[model samples]
Target: MNFGDRVKEVHREILSTPHGDLPQEFVTEAVWRGEAAYFLGWAIQLFDKPHPSTFTDPGALTGVLQLLQPDANELVPSARLRAHPEIDDYSALCLLIRHLLQLQEMQAGGRDSLERAYQSRLAKLGLSPASNRLEPGAADAVISSTAKDSRGLYVVRSLAAEWLLGEEE
Candidate 1:
């Protein structure tokens, strides 16, 4: 069945239920959960089918990676790419689903690892972290020693996404 079909039915059921009349956090969570689940399920079923190998080429992936800036702030809280009980914008959801597909293929093909990608980036900037976690380098100080370059938010977003994705993998 379609996402609209499933969600509309939920809306109908919720409107009829006692919780439906009460606009509360639980209701919001319920609706978001349903939507997120629906989208993820749809994405899995749709992409799991056979497709051309052109989509999995390394050069194509590199191009895609080059253009993909962290978009953690683009989607609404519920509409993020996470598979949590929340809503996400259509664009954000689509990008996430597509990225998952690409990452899976890249792994299967034995291509460059995401860790390597991050490491190479830091190397270019002459910055390397000794640990897996990114220390803000503000230990024992009120101010962060590492200066912000306006993309600090993006780094936080990327790290969060990477953490979540790593858990899944």
Candidate 2:
């Protein structure tokens, strides 16, 4: 079924169990759990069959990424990260997804890697980590650093700087 139908199904299931009959804490936990599950399912579907628009339009891709962020952020609490012992790999996942999309658009004999594409794009826009000059490997370094952690990935500070500088315009 489509996303709307799935959302409606979840809503029906949640409402079917009367909230008043459950403890307040239990109800809250259940709702959050259900929402997380729904978002996870949706994200899986997107990864399995990514819409064409997501690849063609930057805004659409951004929206899909944004939709997944809330669930990803809430799914694992920071305190529990120590007990469960998992690193936040969301940035790596996003980079992989973006690379997959870019690869799909490349010619069969194209030799460019995703890193190359990122570097080329940044160079074409004259964006460096410091914004003053493009050192030989600066783009690669910046993108690599950003992909290494969630904090760098979340705001995409360098990418935002490029956009604010009107490079895309």
Leading candidate by lDDT: 2
**Model 2 Cα lDDT, one tens digit per residue, 47-105:** 22222111122233334433333443433332121111111122223333344445656
Alpha-carbon local distance difference test for all models: 0.33, 0.37
Expressed as tens digits, the lDDT of each residue in 1-169 for candidate 1 is 1233344654545434553364664565444333333333323332221121111222322232221223422322333243322212222222233333345457554445754654564344223322223234322121122233321222222233333334211
Clashing pairs in 2: none
Give Cα distance to truth, residue 159, candidate 1, Å: 13
Candidate 1 structure, TM-score to reference: 0.21
Please name the candidate that would achieve the greatest TM-score relative to the true structure. 2
Q: What TM-score, computed on C-alpha atoms, does each candidate reach?
A: 0.21, 0.22
Q: Considering summed lDDT, which 10 consecutive residues are worst modelled in model 1?
A: 46-55
